[model samples]
Target chain A: MFWMTWRQHRLTLASLAVVFLGLAGGYLLSGAAMRGSLSLEAVQKCFVGTPLTCPEWAGVISTDRNLRQTLLPVLPALVGVFLGAPLVSRELEQRTFRYAWTQAITPRHWLTSKVLLLGSAVTLLGAVFAAVYRWWFTPATTGAVTLYDWFDVFDQGVLSFPSACLFAFALGVLAGTLTRRVVLGMGSALVGFLAVFLPLAIWVRPNYLPTLRVDADSYYSQSGGWATDFVYLDRDGNEFGMWEALSRAGVTSTTSFGSEQEELLARAGFREMVDYHPGDRFWVFQLIEAGIFVALAAGCVALTFWLVRRRSV
Target chain B: MTETAIAATRLGKRYGQKWALRDCTLRVPAGRVVGLVGPNGAGKSTLMNLLVGLDRPTTGELDLLGERVGPNRALDRVAYIDQEHTLYRNFRVHEVLKAGRLLNPRWHEQDAVDRLHELNIPLTSKVGRLSGGQRAQVAVAAALARRPDLLILDEPVASLDPVARRDLMATLMAAKADRDCTIVLSSHVVSELERLCDHLVVLDHGEVRLAGDIDDLLDGHRLLTGPAATADRAPVGTCRVVHQERAGDQVSLLVRGAPPAADPAWHARRVNLEELVMHYLASAADTTGGGKHPAVLG
Candidate 1:
């Protein structure tokens, strides 16, 4: 049954090959670009900034690392949506599920075998992609990768992506079974996939980890409306007070608060607290999300089986 | 004990407010090719689906090969070919046969391959590339290769050309000759049914209008034509009148039973299987007033 399912998805396997080649080529070119810009002197210069003096935001040009890190977290999701859409939809669209289901096997058996076989393949591809990305970026981040990245790259590739694909596939199967039209199945799968995904991406992730920030000076200024002078203290215990003298003294700067009247005090010593670091914790989170997605996929699969077995066609 | 190939007790099915099949009690022993015949939407496919456990029945019980319908065991012994082409178009014919082998515990790869070769179907040719008739043949090959205990087909030849349909039917007949499998096939092509079937079941408006051995059903039934007076005064014997039409004093009546001894007034002739089936179906359709309601005939 597994081999039969593999044969059934031969096109998908070919698609996966295309995906792998594309990812690999893109990674190689991007790595070459990053390496071209990275000299030993450049690395030293990046770390040789004036300490605890002023906001260093000016020097932080959005580098390839930054872009890759930001984009990498969401790449698997798009892949998930794309790869998952055709898992069941195309078969149903072509009226082939009826053939597979009526074999000397129950609907559950048929579905289970396909899910296991295809899900494993998707997961392996995802893990390999994630591993490759990790190898390329490990020199810089050095294991600081977050659960978000792992889930986005590895866990989702194997677990969540496959689950989503299964969900979409089952949805397509149900639509096809009921409507007996492949177009309806494809359309419903797209609509349903987005309906489940967009909301979770926009509304859910932020709430999952609540962050509380306290701007002490802003609170002080609000409570006691004083036109205070900027105070600057060096790491060597040298101190300067008042606005013009503070400017000469360095170590602190005032930036405009949006397009507002009041100037906001920006401190240089402390960077914003990052809630979750990239690494083991991220993997844990990925496992949890994967578990949830797998559960949902399993539910959809069960419903699909019930629908197929009980359905008239 | 080895169970009957298929058994149903008051098995029924409903699609929302509409009932597709009701009070369908059938027991088909192994090793016989039974033909199910009906017009469009006459519940023939519905009955086949129920027997093969493709669709669950709304009421009563169904058992296939001793296992309850809907379980894996029942499905393992049963193979079904629906009215539509079921083979994946993207896969070559060989892949479809390989799928059958993987799916069925009692698969016969050699037989399937040989049959495909004999039918002139290229193993490497994808189903999508084949003509409609060729695709239908591939579906038949896949289903038959499984070597199942019970094979249920719903309009398997609906899309096939005459030659392909004849070849498929002959292949199925040969398989039956070689095995102890029970076959229940449904088709609107009554002539083919007449050629292939030993037993017959006729369905109309989701009910069993008539079901029995073809020979027995035909022997007991006769079409009688004569004057109204002669027909009315004729000995009834073991016959029951089913349909009647009158042209002035001349009347024609369709009855089910043997001829009366030494009867001279009435002209009694045995009906051909196709004509007999058409008569039952026409009467059934009329009884339900254009097939809106269900009607059962014994």
Candidate 2:
């Protein structure tokens, strides 16, 4: 079974690995170059008055945001389209499954063994991407950003990201089993990968741990946390709208704010409160997300087993 | 060794509203070359699929080599080639044989290699590049090398030209000469099995029409020819007319059970295997609202 799987998909697997490794190498090199000239230590030493001028540690962070917006929806599902979708769909579509299943082994065993070997290949590559991606943005994430920025890093961490890859592969198998069409299965895998992770990212993840509320004098004190929402309360301790506070401070227009905006809001009889998840809970959220995806992956694998056993084709 | 190789008790398969096969009960004895004969959609492939465990029965029981049709039960002892003659077109011919060796618990690499060499099939050529006849030979070589106790081929020669069909059957007969395997081959063409099979099973519209030893089936029935005017009258003794056709003023009827041939009313001759199979299939078509429709309209 192992030989057959490899023999059939060696070219596809090799191409995917090359593409993933190339992307990883690019990210690592660009990340290292971000801090090559002006190291963080130089910025620290400038404060000692030796160099007198602080050379800013300029790390490109906008690309990371773009990746989160664009690449993430399609990245992990590449394995689904190239590897997992065609795993069973090819056999079924081409009618080679009739030949494969009638051997000494059972169809369930044939499908299960092939999926395990190939699933491990994708998961290993996904780990490489996760570790490299997290390292790629390490300088920017730790230098001047809030701990809330670490949430994005955790999304690309070993636990969560690799689980998404495995989940997508398993979903591709299930789609192939259901539809028995190679193209349709690949499409479903891509769509399902986003349908699951997009909702988790938007609504389910932040709720994994309860939000910590903080009373801080200035926004700087809450910089390291994921500041999801801000509440403006009058001295009477009742929450008021931000627009009301701005208008009461005689802010005629909403378009621009001066450097003294904090003082203006403070003078409007408002105290600031923040609801956030601390940066220290990074691994905890990673584990939660990974557990959910892995659980779903296991369900798809088990269902594929049952389907292959009873499948007439 | 004389035990039944395949036994199905009231086996049936229904897809949605239509039944592809229904109430099909059969027992094929071990070591006999059996022909499962039927017309298109006569449940021949359906029965073969059930024997090979490719399909589950909607009702009733099926046993292959005294074992239930489940994963890995009788699988090692059974080999099946579907109607399409499935193979991985991407792999080389030798790689296909290697796959057979790797997949089966019992491997006969020498036998497969020797057979292919004898057939002059190029081992290095990709299966996709091989001719249809060569591909079919490779499939047969792999199957025969498995040394299964029961070999089921579903419409094995349906796609082959006459020469390929003859070559494939020759190889099969040569393999059957030595092995103790029971072969159940399904074909819509009766002439193909007339020269190959010892036992016969005929089906029509998902039901069993006739089944027994080929010689026994032939001997148990006789063809009676007489005037068309007397065709409506029953024959002498317990003989029953299975099928009949008219030409000019004469009508010939296939009668089951031996009638007294010495009677002066009609001429009696022994029925051939093709005649027996065609009569059963034709009579089945008659009862199923299909036969003689054009004739009646004309």
Candidate 3:
């Protein structure tokens, strides 16, 4: 069964390997050049004190960053489209499932073998890509890229890529089983990946842990935390909206504020409060998100088996 | 070994509100070449699907080779060839045989390879590129290589040319003779069934209309031509009239179960397999309104 599955998908596997090798090779070549330039004395000095002094090195850094930001997000969707959608839909569309399901091996075993083999391949590919991406972005140690923030692509590139790949693979299998059309399955799987990913990234991830509140004066001093919201507190520590406090201070436009007005407001027992997630919680959030995605993938796989068992060929 | 290869009691299958097969009670004895004859919508495919455990019965029980029909067990001992001869089009001929070897525990690899070679089918060619007759042969070779106890073919030769059909039947006969396995072949072509099968099961209106040894069925049924005045009157003796026709002053009756005592008034002749199947199917259609229109008979 394993050999048959491998033979059946040999072309798909070869294409995926070529694409992976191309991306990895590109990343390695450009990453080495960026590392070589970042090690120069001028670039090192500029990183310590000056801005816009090393235009050549800065151009290389910005270009690499732009490429990573654009391409990393698309990796999971590629896995969903190529590896996951066609697993079952092709058999159904071609009517080869009639031969497949009638073999001496039961349908359950047939599905299990395919899912295990392909799902492992996808996860392993994601892991390799993640490792290479992490290596490529090693310049983050020089304080060039914000690697620890939840919103940064580094989090998605490192931990979330494999998790998202697993989830997308399962989603594709479910969509293929339901639609019984390869193209439609691929489309739905891509849409499903975005639908689940965007909402969680935007709304659910920030609240996975309790937010820390600090005085506005120390917001900038707390450099490793991701600040999300601001509030104003009175003398008794009663919280109020920043807009309400600004309006009460006779400041019509909060964006333009004089230093004297800021001093006055501070002396009047008005303290600004900042809400943020500390940098140390980055791994915690990664684990939480990965867990959620893995659980959803398992659910989709179970549902796929149930659907296969219930429906007639 | 069990005497019966397949035994179904009130087997039925329904798709939403419509029953594709209903109350289909049948018993096919082991080691006989049985022909399942039915028209386009006579539930032939549905019954075959159920027998192969591709679809579950909605109403009753079905056993294949003394074991309950199910995805896990029945498929181990039974091989099925669907009407379309479904195979992976992307696979080469040899790869298909390799798949059969990988999937079936009892797969006979050399037999499949030899059969395809004997037919001059190229092993390196993709199945999608093969002609319809070649694909059908590949399907048969794959099924036979499994060495199953019972082989159920669902209209496998319906689209083949006459020569290809004859070759396929001859191959099937060779396989049956070699392995001594029971075969249930379904087809709408009565003449082909007459040539290929010894036992007959006539299905119409989703029910088994006639079933038994072909010779016994033929011996029991007779075509009687007599005067028109005697047609309305029931035939004497144990024979049950199945169909009646009138032309001018002569009346013809097709009866089942017994041949009446020789009376000089009526001319009685033994019914051939095709005529016996047609009369049974036509009568079944008349009663249930689900088979070929009876007007085709006239």
Candidate 4:
């Protein structure tokens, strides 16, 4: 199985080199460009009132805000899709499973060897990317905000990024094992990721976040017909709009207003109120979701192993 | 009792409406090389597949190296060289051999590597780039390297050129000479089987037309030539009449059984392995009425 896997993946070592060089080169050049513009002399003179330049570390961390924000989520997911699609499907496609299964070792041992060997390579690649992201972004405090104090809809934790990537990888493996076609596996994985992510990001959590609601008649009387149109929610650093008063009214049932949200609304004495404002337990939510996603990823990996081991072809 | 290296009793397999192999009972003792010969679609591969545990027999049992090998066989003890190139083409020759070593518990890695070296197969050369004969050699090397107690080959040298075929047969012969591993090889090429096989199992459709020690099969089987009109009557002590053909006054009847020397008018002739196979196939086809869809020998 290692021999077979190596045949498929060994050629990608060159591609790995190219991606690594491209990422580092892009990061370094952006940092250099930022350093040129944000010089200590210029910053001190231009923004003399603000203490933005007190620590040199912050400048280095914020070198390439756009690049970090754009590349972080996309790169790992791409790696997962690229590497996972062929991991098992290639064997079945080639019809070489016959050779492996006829050996003294059971199918379990055969699959275990492949997963242990190839999975280590994937883990190493992900780790290197994570380390680079950590190093390059430690100074540039500007980018997609983490779950530190800000509560953006995408404020998953530090591990969530890799966990998401690993989840995508496992998804790819599962797709390949089940479908036994590289193109189909890749397509299914991409489709599944979008299917899960779009709903979770756009619909589920946002509506669930603590919100404030008011009757259109009363609020519109006070603020003019503005209450009938929409309500733009600003919770932590994230912003979203509920379309019209009717949609905003549904937000109460969606978020499942907890005791804390109920108490806050009671203090304010509002008719309808669900607010996802900043709170201490936001990090706890991040940890819990990360755990769930990571556990899901683990389950996907386990299922792939089972399917590959048992499949006749 | 002398241990039988391989045994199949009432082995049967059917695919949909077609019976690929049925009621196949044969035994080859330890250290004997068995040749399973038949026409294309004659259940040779099906029987081999059943023995190797690649496909289960629909009705019967197979015992290999003392273990019943249907659902609970120790598959590792048996080495199967499939009819196609089983090696991953993208892997190097050395790596393919390494995979054999990793998968088989009793692999004779050095012997396999040495044979590959002798054949001048490149260790670092990828299998995809190798010639057809060379690719075949790599598969053979992997099978032989495992030093399995029973080596089952299905059309082992089907695609090789004449010279490569000779060399491969020589290598297989040498392996059998070194260790008394039972080798059961299936081939349509009877000439090749004549060189190495000690036991014979002749199949037509899904049934065994004839089977026994090579000497016994050859001795008991004969082709008799007489007038076309004389062919209608069965020969005395005839077990089976393979085929009958006529040209004017001359009629050739391929028969299985010893003919009396006293019969002067009827000529009794011995048949080689190839001639015997042709006769069986021709007769098997004739019984099916010589149509495009030949009836399987039930």
Candidate 5:
């Protein structure tokens, strides 16, 4: 069964390997150059309150960072489209399942073997890609690059990326089983991955860890955290939006009261608060999101097995 | 020891509101080449699929070689050749044999290899590139290599030319001679079935219209030609009238289960397998309102 799986999918796997190697090579080359620029003495001094050559070094890091960030999300999509969607859909579309399922091995065994072998390969590939990207984009010890803040890259370079790949692969399998058409399955899997991923990344991930409430005066200086909300608290400790508080204070225009109203509000115990998640919770958030995706992947696999067993040829 | 190759009691498969096969009960003894004849949508494929465990029956029970049909022990001893001769088009001829060997514990690799070689089929050719006849042969080789106790082939030669059909039948006969395995082959061509099968099963409208040994069915059914006046009355004997047709003053009757006693007014002749099968199918169609033939019964 292993040999059969390999023989059938060798071309797709080889093509994926080539693309991965190309991406790795590209990252390694640019990464070495970025490290060389960050290691300079002038760059090191400029990172610590000096303005000389800092902008130049920051430019180099941002150039590499921007490209990596844009391409990183596509890796899981590629795995889903290439490996996962066609895993079963191709056989069904071509009527090859009739031959495959009728072998001495049962359909359940055939599906289990394929999913295990191919799913593991997809997970491992995602891990390798993540590891390479992580090593390439490691922050400098003391340089302008050291002050660089990019939470998206950190989240993507850890366990979250590989977990997302697994989820996408399983989603592809489910879509393939349901649709029984390779192109439709691939399209639906890609769409399904995005549908699941975007909601968690945009809405759910920030609250995975407890948010911190700090004075709004210090919010601008707190550069290494994600700010979720800004609200004003009344003397009774009830939170209200800026417009509602202003309306209650009978100030329809914000330009009219200016700083005087601010002092009066502060004296009356109306403090503006900022809700945020600090940067230090990056690993914690990674694990939480990874757990969510892994759970989803398991669900997709379970559903696929149940459907395969129940479906008629 | 059990001598039945296949036994099904009220086996049925339903697709939504329609039944592809229903209430199909049959018992085929071992070591006989049985021909399954049916028209389009007659449930021949459905029955074969059920026998090989490709699809589970929606109702009732089916047993193959004394074991229940399922993914367990039954599959290891029963091989199936689907109507299309489904093989991996990407794999080379030898790779298919290798797959058979890997998938089956009792695979006879040398026999498959030898059979392909003798048929002048190249080992390196992709299955998709082979001619229809060659593809059928490779499929047969793969099935035979498994050394199954019962081989169920659905429309194996439905698409082959006469020459290819002959070659395939020869190959099947050789395999049966070597292994003494029970073979159930389905086809719409009655002449081919007559030449290749000792036992016959006719299906129509998802029901078994006729079934028995070829010789027994032939011996039981007699074609009687007489005046149209006598056609309205049933033949005198233990025989049952299966079908009748009248043209001008002549009437012809197909009788089943017994041959009528000799009468000077009627000329009784033995019905060929094709005529017998056609009559049963026509009668079934008429009974089901699928055709214009009038239903006749004794």
Candidate 6:
């Protein structure tokens, strides 16, 4: 049964290997080059963000590591659509499952072995790529503070990315089993992954640990605002945004909260309040998110397994 | 194990609200070639699926090779090749045989290789590139390699050309001569099963219309020719008229059971497999008020 799985999926596996090697090699070269460029003053200046003072740093950063950040999701999506969706649906759509499921190996054993081999491959590669990403990102901040936002760190982190790969692959299998058509299965996997992923990242990840509130002198500094979002707190410790403060000071949009609003904010003793899941909580969030994703992955796989056994034509 | 290769009692399979095959009670003694002959949508495939355990029965019990159908019970004992003879289109021919060797605990690898070699099928040829005949042969080779006690094939040559059909049948015959396995295959073409099967099953409207050893079924049916005016007047002698057709001044009546006591008024002879199947199918359609076109045998 394992031999049959290998024979059937060797082509998809080889292509994925080529893509994985290309991405890994490309990231390694770019990350190493960036590490060497840290000696340059301009490179150091743009490390925080798009510093207007250094056009060369902006050019390099934008053209370089920014792509790697966005490319993280692509790997998992490929695993889901190309690998997982076709695993069952192709067999069914092509009418080959009629030949396969009738062999000496039952459908249950056939699926179990295939998932074991392919799922292990997905998880191992996902882990390796994630570790490479963490290595690539570490030098940008020099271990002092985060240069990107919490979401960026959370996305390219070591633990959660691997679990996300498993989740996508498993969801793909579930979609393929339910849909029983290749293109439809691939589409469902993509849509399902996004449906679960966006909400989890946007609404759920930050709340894994309660936010730590801190008062910062500057509202737009790399530490207080870039890494975390901040709102204004009045003398009464009431949180407020620019709209409330501007309206209270009678500053219209035409004034753009010019010096008049600033004066009023100062008089009211309004300070920038930063609510953040601190850097120390990064791993804790990773652990929690990883657990949720793995559980979801298991759920998808369990459902797929049950459907394979129960479903018939 | 029981000598009965397949014993299905009231076996039925339904899709949605309609039954594809229903109330089918079939029994085949071991070691004989069984032909499941039917027209399109006659539930031949459905019955084969139940026998091979590819489908769950909607209504009854099936015991194959003396074991109940399930994930663990009959998988290794039965080998089935479906209508299209589906294989991994991307894999080379040798890889498919290798998969067979690896998947089945009882596989005979050399036999598959030798079978392919005799058919002059190249081991390195990709399955997608092979001819339909070659694909069917390769599928048969793989199925035979498993050394199954019972082999079930559904519409094995429904799409093959005449030459390919003859060639695949030859391969299947050779395999039968080489093994002690019981083979049950379905085909809509009556001629296809006439030369290959000793036991016959006729399925129409999702029901078994006629089933038994071919010789026994033939002995039970009689074809009578007489004047059109005398078709109803002739002594049928405990025989039931199955179908009647008139050509000009003469009438041909297909009867089941004993002939008209060898009357001189009519000529009586045994029915062939094709005529027997067509008569039963035509009579079934007649009973159902044109449920199926009787010309389906064409």
Please give, for residues A1-313, the per-residue lDDT of candidate 5 as tens digits.
8999899999988887777667767667766665677665554454344334576556555665576557667578777888888988898898878788777888888888888998888777777777877766554333433554446475455698888888888998888888899999999998988898878778888788779999887876655666778788998889988667777666666757567777766766688899987777777877888899899999998988887777642
For all candidates, state DockQ relative to the true structure: 0.51, 0.63, 0.62, 0.46, 0.55, 0.59
Which digits, one per residue and each the tens of the lDDT, describe model 2 over residues A93-132? Answer: 9989889888888877787788889889988988998888
lDDT of 1 by residue, A139-236 (tens): 33322221123323332333444454445545544554555555565566567656765565455543444333323354333321111123434344
Q: Which tens-of-lDDT digit does each residue in B27-64 have in candidate 4? A: 88888899999878999988887777667778888888
Which residue pairs collide, candidate 5? none
The TM-scores, chain A only, for the candidates as listed are: 0.58, 0.84, 0.84, 0.60, 0.80, 0.86
How do all models score by TM-score? Answer: 0.77, 0.91, 0.91, 0.73, 0.90, 0.90
Q: Which scores higher on DockQ, 3 or 4?
A: 3
Say which prediction, candidate 1 or candidate 5, comes out ahead on lDDT: 5
Where in model 5 is the C-alpha error above 4 Å? A36-60, A140-150, A216-225, A232-272, B71-74, B292-298
Model 3, B1-298: lDDT tens digits are: 6899999999999999999998988888899999999888889998987888777789999988888876455277788888889999888999999999989999898899999999999899999999888999999999999998999999979988888888999999999889889999999988887777999999886888889999888888889878887666545477778887667778778987666576677888888988888778778767765444433223
Q: Model 3 chain B — which ten-residue stretch has the worst lDDT?
A: B289-298
Candidate with top DockQ is 2
Clashing pairs in 1: A123-A158, A144-A278, A145-A278, A145-A279, A146-A278, A146-A279, A147-A282, B220-B257
Q: Residue B147, candidate 4: how far off, in angstroms?
A: 1.6
Q: Could you tell me the TM-score of candidate 2?
A: 0.91
Q: Give the TM-score comparing model 5 with the true structure, all chains together.
A: 0.90
lDDT of 3: 0.80
Q: Stretches of candidate 6 above 4 Å error?
A: A33-46, A49-60, A142-151, A217-229, A235-238, A254-263, A269-271, B72-74, B226-234, B244-252, B291-298
- Candidate 5, residue B128: the lDDT equals 94
- What lDDT does model 6 reach? 0.79
State the lDDT of candidate 6 residue by residue for A183-297, as single tens digits: 9999999988888988887787767877767665433354522234567787777778867865664555654656676677777677767777655577777899899989998
Q: Rank the candidates by DockQ, best first.
A: 2, 3, 6, 5, 1, 4
Write down the RMSD of all candidates, one decimal each.
Answer: 8.4, 3.6, 3.3, 8.1, 3.6, 3.5
Share of true Cα-Cα contacts across chains kept by each model:
0.67, 0.60, 0.58, 0.52, 0.46, 0.73
Indicate the docking level reached by candidate 1. Answer: medium
Better of 1 and 6 by DockQ: 6
- DockQ of structure 3: 0.62
Task: Summarize candidate 3's per-residue lDDT along A126-225 as a digit string, tens digits.
Answer: 7777778667654443354333343455345556778888888899888888889999999998998889887887788878988999887787664556
